[model samples]
Target: MAAMLTQFEDLAADNTSGATELIQRILALCESGAMGNTYNEIREGLNLLEDAHSSMPSLHTVIQILKSEFLPGLKNADDLEQSLRYIVSLQKILEESGAQIAEKFLSVLERPTRILTISRSSTVISALKKAHKANKLSHLYVLEARPAYEGWRTVRDCSAAGISSTLMVDAAMGEAVQTAEAVVIGADSVSSDGYLLNKTGTLPLAICASEFGLPLYVLCDSLKFSPQTRRDVTIDEHPDSEVIEKEESDAFKVWNRYFEWVPINYVEAFITERGVFPPEELEALSTEETAADE
Candidate 1:
């Protein structure tokens, strides 16, 4: 249990990984905990994870599944084995969902297309790789997500995959959008009101894409869809030192927020593992999912 808690703590402190990667790590931690710990200890570890990453609805969904469906049945070693199997199955499903979403997104693009994207999204990187393999990708424009500079990881991944990519500053989003054929990004969460919560620069990128009449695609799995509205979500503020080296003076204030909400009206479509959905259709989809859970 102590080892499991340490793993969860490490995951919580990780700001470099994308949402999909984080969810995958959460499942892995849960699987390890379920195998070695008692039901109560696993539950305690999960509670710690939940408190640490409360903003991630997808992570919460995985926790909810374990709590309501699997944990209750953990009465013996056999039950623990069954729970481990289920967790492994969930991990497999998540892995497949990324590929499925990539396929759907690639189908909508023209061959030899240039894509502009912000931040480091594992899902977007996978889709980009698939597109490159299929001869659909020409070039990629990656915005160097500020403060954390997560986009550097994306550029590195693209280079390793032999995909042509250019790294630009976040402020150059307008130029990037105008130069690219389309804008593709990943979402942290999609609210019931059809708003997208993602990396801080996403809103500006969407606006630029809209101004240039380019399609803005959000590539994510259905697990990112949240029952909460934008009002209910809290945007995380990072350390001020990330923005400036000096301490805050009385004259100036440094605001280092890492996430922001993008109005869905600017988006062309949401390409998910299930299918492509327009912004307007999201409300009904959220409603259906919420009803199913109830």
Candidate 2:
């Protein structure tokens, strides 16, 4: 399963033949209980496919639709990365207008232009690094997304080059969101209507940011924007084996999902290389897309 998912991502990175079918297979693996070596793998696989498909915008539109509605469930991110490295090698090919959309979206985040900073990890943090120079990121409050704690890596990478950064419990996001000028978190997938499904705590944070009137920015490469829309984005749920031995708890009904949906209303803006827009803006974007097709 791990090997298969890796192949799928590689296909995605190249934007070559078999990518769509390969992606379908990868999703199947994720849902098939091959969770052990698939957790983090699917995210990478999806990212590559999303990025690659971005260049072929029309194709991406289709891919996004499929991904949003239903993504396979995988468990154990570490085990899933074997194939990730393969696709990582193909990054350059995957970026295109999709990457631009991602960058443009993130740039708009600096309202006062430069004050408080945002924190993120995984693909999003990587996307931010590409657009903002380390020094440019200097006062941003980049938090370490936890459990996976990939945010530590973001801090290290961003700070090493001079981006002032920090690490915090995923639980601390509320306080951070309340004080930060903008919450520029990354996105794993976006539903049409502009809802975001990302790391577990994202939904609540978006709400908190909304409650506090803070800007909640979703930084994603346009490619990361799955072809799928609202009804398309499906939550990937993992097995209880991840939490307990199944022997440990008498009532072990663990419903663990790697990502979640942040309703459009909760999202302040979407940061893609294309530039940021208010959540309502997605409605307009959708309309434009429809009109163009017509």
Candidate 3:
């Protein structure tokens, strides 16, 4: 557990990394014998990561959501081999879903054009790479996701990949949106109603996209879906040090929230493993299902 938690910390601390890679490392720990014999034991490991690490909701929520789909099938598996088999099965599902989600983006990126995205979503990065390989991506406009300045990492990555991209300040999202034909983002969680919880500043960018009559798309696997609504998730605020690196004068306070909820109305569609779906199309899959419902 200590070693696994350390891995999560190192991955989370890097502003450039995303939840997909984080989750993959966590699962690799499990595959290498970190997972215990019973389903509860495995879940306890995940719970510890959820409680202790500053990881994103999507990291834990993806497994939690998949638990509902796969755990019941494991009920009849009484031996360790059987238990591990189910674990391996779940891992395969996640990996394949990621590939399919990337493919969806490749299909959508039909021409060489500029796109605007903020923060760093592993899902978004993978898709962009695929689109670039197909020669469909001309440029990317990345916002300097403030405090952390994750956009610098995005620019670095795009440049390394031989894709043309520009980094702009957070406030320049409105300007970026004017030239971008569409806006794409990654989600930390998607409510049953299709609202998105992502890095701070995403909501305003979506609003800008809406006002400019541009479509905003979210790229994520189906595992990112959460039964919880926006009200159920606790949105955490980061330390003021991330915002102001000065004397501890109590003259003013800084509300540095790392994430915010973007209403479903602002989103045009979601690109999931299944395919691109309008917000309403996700309703059936996002609904909280009972054992019987499953």
Candidate 4:
């Protein structure tokens, strides 16, 4: 995930060579057959590239042409270069507007306010870092997103960047929410109905945020949008080993679900590269797509 974001960062200056090299690297990774999450990585890269090229109409036109010309007949994964180009082209339409979306989030922040968040997302982290740099962030409250403990990494990174943050057990989220000004999260996927599928524990945090009347902001690029609805999306069950050790086996079953669903109404707004959008707007967007698909 970090590597994919790094590739996007290389395109910060709108360098075509940088974008091409990133695509080449992505293709190489795809060919290596080691990418456990190729589709998401592609979306992330595409989101970044789209942001970099948002102001360049000629480049945007090139992206559209690439998608229109290459994507339709993509039959298999073996067509690696074609697939990469197709992804880049698809990004032009599907990726969010860009880092400007993150900038839009700064309006909701007040100086010296505590923001609650969970897990690690390149997009969410980048927004928080930006807020910190602007001196709008006073503190960050992170839940120790477990089975993987990705939140620990978030806390560590925040500390390294000189942002004061606290790491708490997942169970402490409700208590933390009481004092937090708002909650921010990253979506693994946003369903057709505008529901967010994110790391486990997000739903409860969202519920808590809603209960307290605190805003819950979802930071993500539009490429995270998936065609599936909540019921249609397959929830992956991770290995029990992720939650338990080999020596700690118990007769009781352990379910290690890596993600959870948070309904759209629980979110205050979606912070995207295009800008902040209400759930109604997302629903409208989805409705338009459904109509177009017919």
TM-score (all chains, Cα) for each model: 0.93, 0.60, 0.83, 0.68
* Candidate with better TM-score, 3 vs 4: 3
Clashes of each: 0, 27, 0, 1
lDDT (tens digit, per residue) of candidate 3 on 212-237 = 99888899887677777777777766
Descending-TM-score candidate ranking: 1, 3, 4, 2
Which one wins by TM-score: 1 or 2?
A: 1
lDDT scores for all predictions? 0.85, 0.53, 0.75, 0.68
Top TM-score prediction, candidate number: 1
* Regions of model 1 farther than 4 Å from truth: 38-41, 73-75, 248-251, 287-294
- Candidate 2, residues 1-294, lDDT tens digits: the string is 567566765665431122223333444544442334444555566666665533233345544543443333123354345334333333433445445654565455443323222334344545556546523343556555534444566667666765555666667777776656666666555666556656667777777777888766665555455446656644545556654566644764766655566677777677655567777777676566668769
- Per-residue lDDT of model 4, residues 1-294, tens digit only: 777567546654422121222333434443332234345554555445555533222233334443445433243456656655554554553324435655888877766578999887756777788898998888999998887888888889888999999999999988999978989987767877557877889988988898888999988765566666678666656677878775654677778876778888888889877667888789666566668769
| lDDT score, candidate 3 | 0.75
Q: Give the Cα RMSD of candidate 3.
A: 4.0
Instruction: Write the residue-wise lDDT of candidate 1 on 1-294 in tens digits.
Output: 576667777877887777789888877777766766667777776777677655567777788888887787566776777788888898999999999999998889867899989889999999999999999999999999998999999999997999999999998888898799999999988887768888888988888888889999999999998878889876677786788777445467779888888999998999999889999888777777779979
Error of 1 at 81 (Å): 1.7
lDDT score for residue 226 of model 3? 71
Task: State how far residue 68 of model 4 sits from its true place (Å).
Answer: 11
Q: Output the better candidate (3/4) by lDDT.
A: 3
